[model samples]
Target: MHAQHDIVIVGGGLVGASLAIALENSGLDVAMVEAAPPGALPPVFDERNLSLAEASCHALQALKIWPLLQTASPIRRIHASRVGDFGRVSLDASEVGREAFGHVVIARDFGEALEKRLGDVASLTRYRPARFIDTQGLADGRREVRVADAEGEHRITTRLLVGADGMKSAVRSSLGIDATRHDYGQTLFVSRVRPQRPPDGTAWERLGPHGPTAFLPRFDRHYGVVHGVPSEEADAVAALDEAAWLARLQDAFGWRAGRFVASGERSRYPAVRVVAERLTAPRAVLLGNAAQSIHPIGAQGFNLGLRDALTLVEEITAHGLDDAAMLESYAARRSEDRARTLAFSDGMARASSNEGLAMRGLRSLGMAALANVPGLRAQVVAGGMGYRGDVPAMCRENAQ
Candidate 1:
């Protein structure tokens, strides 16, 4: 006899963990298979900085996870400009009738909070330090997942199997779902730095020939820096000493954020975009990076993934996992938001790095329009705060 669950979530990272937390006390048997051991941080919860959109914050709050994040920093304002360009745009949350557009959080800190919250989910069963071996379809239209832990392999049958395992998803592959990948040919470096003039509730994005150099506010009064460079130059740049790298950052970003007087450890990774050809297959579905791994530019990766999780929860609760039509409806509902976000991130990544005169001119004009037009600016602000498409109930303003 196999262990049984109404839902089995593969990957206990941010998105998967969030889903489990949202389903707490919902009268469903849930199981989570995580590769990390107890109290260990997953690779997704490393030193990276995440910018949580306002909608994501609301969803987290609804799931009772936001209050646990004591170190989150609110983003009250946004400043966007291109180096050597006369056009610049500044947006304030007050203009959009909100307290903030979102918050900036360290990935590891958020993960710790998620781990703590997961313990409170009464209906969740966890399989820690486990690897998802494979899955098989049952004659009754259900799925059986094989997870291997220290005690060896265990079989669990589920009405719905969720693939929140991220970029290289095993669940997606087992479902025979194809994904399209695009390499941006760029590398992003992330680190924390103390500047002469630290962040004051403002986030800055400075675009250059290479890519955007972003400085996000952090709770510890330090700026979380994300710098991008050409792939060929990543090694050379990484080899630079702290002082030299700080100097390079200052030169690239200008004195707007002030001089960097001190720095912390830095991590770097190649920027790539991967989008699954489809969102659902039979009794299984994908979320977060498994559905779409977008570029870090615009900071939409996690926010988009969180929305996916929340939306799926809504669908599952409304129709249950046994409803085949509910799965199709979930895919249809997510199509617009997913497509729009992917296009925006990919477009920004390419446009910001293109040195062509025409592209530069267009960027300048766009910035000018956004700066001078309140209606246009408000629309942009709304989208930036994750108000696109069919808004999930938890993400809505009146969501309790």
Candidate 2:
């Protein structure tokens, strides 16, 4: 059977689902193709902690997804310091005329919230447990896509095709788009730990020779910890017992959040940077990890991807998706934000891992500047809260 839609999104993960839901009132017929079965969490949703920027929260609020989140810990303050360094930077949301910089939510919980919100989108048709096979451009400027399911192969025709299929995107390959990959050579381990003092709305970052170790506040009174180790030591670190792992984390992170008493299951993710050569091709476009995937050093991966989704929604609502001009405009609008964010994440990953004396001095100076200069610090805060470049309406104040 053949299906027709204004748009067919080929991934129902975080960014893809958010895009589909944000277009709920756009009066467009949309179809979402997800590889995961109904009621099952997507691979992207794991035990990792996600730091949602304030702007991201606003966008989710506008989509009516934020209210469905059962547990989220607000990040009222952020503290950053390096091992064996005297320079430190502390930022409080109140200093910037905001209640909080952002909130932290577990990836699994956020995925559940997205799944719930997606079910309520009246205009969206979902194809769960379906795999995208291939696509071809049609004579009428639309594209025909083949999807595989248990029943058989089905064809879908759409004015616009979205490749939110993530790092290894079939749609991107079919569109003949090339992407560059950069390996950071670091493995990040994430889990929850019960700290003696508990989390008090403070997010801490302790940078070391290997990578950054972050402690984010969680609603359950447990601290969400991310410890990064060199890629060569990943297996050894992962093999550590609970007691040994906790001890290592404490050693790297210091005693700011107090000693970690109890720990939970651990998850490790290899750090790699993936950026598509371009963001759009013909009637197809890329979103989230399909377009670019950066290091999680600043917890900017999902937040940046969400912005990409919301921005595309705005463009689609303003200008119909029938023309190549609309996609070109979308790509141009995303250029600056994408470049800056990619640079920031990649630079942080490299800088923190460099143990050379010159790099260490530069890091110390940078921290001092961020701690002392109000203007510089404000810029950092703005970027941290996801307010850089052209802000999307859904992420702006009083949106919706």
Candidate 3:
């Protein structure tokens, strides 16, 4: 029942799919196992808008996935501010030389684009909604996976095993890796709606005592809003009908751009941070949310995962996918990146989401400093774009 391949990735989410394509045409046989299918996928991006850095754009373009994501909207500018009962600090794109701080992509469109590209990849084998039977890695560094399909037991063995399964990753558990979990007790209410005025290619966030209200530009006239609040308070806030909820959001958010009213359906999800104790061991490695799921306050959860995926692809390509040295290098290379990003994101959520005058002052100071310091601003952009350090092969210019 065992089939042989060069790599076996568990989970076909965004990170895994992108990694598979990155490894394609490199003479490596990649078999992807997923617990779910892409059928009945969500229509439109709904309320999820991700800020993509220029480096991410490069990686996607190199992977040839960007061509399929034509519908994505560019964030020509980012307008950030801390809204206390007193003062505010704003950061405009003009602070940086780039026309926009980054681009904001709708997840639905992003997923659909990736799925379409996946269809054309001849090297990929997808097992949708497949039930895992068992997995064992031999002392020789070879790994085998067993799963139950309609026909029953089926197996595949590969040189490397990957866990891209997500927050509660089964692959992570199977590898006996424990994760450090943090429950913020906050729910994120998200949706796309028509606001009173155009965002003018600028992304805006108002930081109040309750939490930060971020508005990311989407389409011609629509915008995506992410409001973080306590779990108990979520039901009351999110439970309101669109009109009622919109009114509430407007009042809490106040008016910086102008006015915001009317919205589409609303969706809320609890916020949490999950970081695995280890990134790799022998033939096993974690990718995407399987490795770390940070707070969404900075819209970094999935964005950070994409960077990890791209880095893995680059390393594996350079030093052979099955090479133990390369695997260890991948783990070491990602450690600092993961640690720094997690700390920054987790800290932001903690600092900005809490009430108190001291926190408000600090938040405002940070924003103001970030606005005035050109070098610091560039560093932030580089960090966001996935090009901060030794450029991975895929992240480099014209990397296949």
Candidate 4:
């Protein structure tokens, strides 16, 4: 099969799907290619819970997907502390005069909602169960992509090629873009838990011997727990019985969110930091995990990727997709945000994992300062809420 479009996105995950929906009625033909079947779940939309920034919620509402996500839990407050440390900070939405810093959503539910609304866009062409094979730059500046699917091979030529296929992006590989990967030597295990005292729309984060443990509020008196463990200890931790695991969790996290009485199946993945050297190549650009994948300490990875998708669309909507200048401008616009996010996330991982007395004392002081200083707290809240630099129109103004 042979097809042509204004843009061909090489990953139909959250970021790519969001971009396709955002480009609706823009008079641009967009094709989204995904290795997963139309209704199948991608790895990105598994059991893990997503902490959506205020800006992300706005973007979703504007994209008309928010209404479909009924089970999302609003995070009225966030509690940050260190086990055995004296300093702690709590950020409340009321301080910012907003309803919430963000919302906690189960990724699977969000994915189902996105899939349900995908067809409504009316202008998107989805290549389901499709995998990118290779690409070649054409004389006319368009990029040619070869994709394999159940039906067989297909050739797609597009003015712009988007690499949203995740950390090991085929589009990036095909374009010969090198990405630096840093393994954090830790694995994040996530699961659902029923705490004795239900979460009151409060998300809790504690750094201790077990690494960073977070409990996020969810619907129906349930909470989502993310426990980071050293690579060597992941197996022992994951292999523990529910009671034992819950005990370990209680020890590392304390009873801030109350004792965990029950838990669901555990899911885990090794934490890695990946950053691409170049965001643009010929007529192509990488978005989401393809461009950079960071630790989940601050829950900033997805939000950053969502911003990338929005910024790319904004550039294309203003400048034609085929314009090299547009690609350059897009790359430049994303450079700072990407750099800062990568550094912040990496720094958090490093700082939180260090158990030295000096580091512990520093963290305690930092936490106390963040808790006591209103200005510093606001800055942290604002940054974590995705209000930092080169605000996308979709993020700044209500998405309508």
User: Judged by lDDT against the true structure, how good is candidate 2?
Assistant: 0.91
TM-score of every prediction relative to native: 0.97, 0.98, 0.92, 0.97
Off-target runs (Cα >4 Å) in candidate 1 are: 397-400
Q: Write the per-residue lDDT of candidate 3 for residues 41-159, one digit (tens) a residue.
A: 42323447777766677778888988888767777766666655344445555555556656788888888888888888898877776766567666466887887777788878878
Over 1-400, each residue of candidate 2 has an lDDT whose tens digit, in order, gives 7989999999988899999999999999999999999879898898889999999999999899999998998999999998876799999998987788999999899999998888899899999899999997775877899999999999999999999999888998998999999988889999999988879999999988788899999999899999989999999999999999999998898888988899999989888898999999888899999999899888898899999999899898788887568988899889888988998999988998888899889999999999999999988889889988877888885622
Q: After superposition, how far is residue 377 of candidate 2 from its true place, in Å?
A: 0.4
> Could you give candidate 1's per-residue lDDT for residues 210-290 as a string of tens digits?
888999999988999999999999999999999999998999998988789998998998899999999998889999999
Q: Local distance difference test, per candidate?
A: 0.90, 0.91, 0.75, 0.88
- TM-score for candidate 1: 0.97
Per-residue lDDT, model 4, residue 354, is 81
TM-score of 4: 0.97
lDDT of 3: 0.75
Give the per-residue lDDT of model 4 (tens digit) for 1-400: 8898889998988898888888996899899999898658787888889999998888888888899999999999999887767888888998888888889999999899888888798889988888899997675878899999988887999888899999888888899999898888888899999989888999999876546899999987989989988889998998899999999888888877777899999999999888989999888899999999899998998899999999998898888876669989998888888888888898888887787899888988998899899899888888898987776888865622
Model 2 residue 289 lDDT score: 94
For candidate 2, give the lDDT of residue 372. 98
Model 4, runs deviating above 4 Å: 398-400
Q: Of the pair 1 and 3, which is ahead by lDDT?
A: 1
Total residue pair clashes for candidate 3: 1
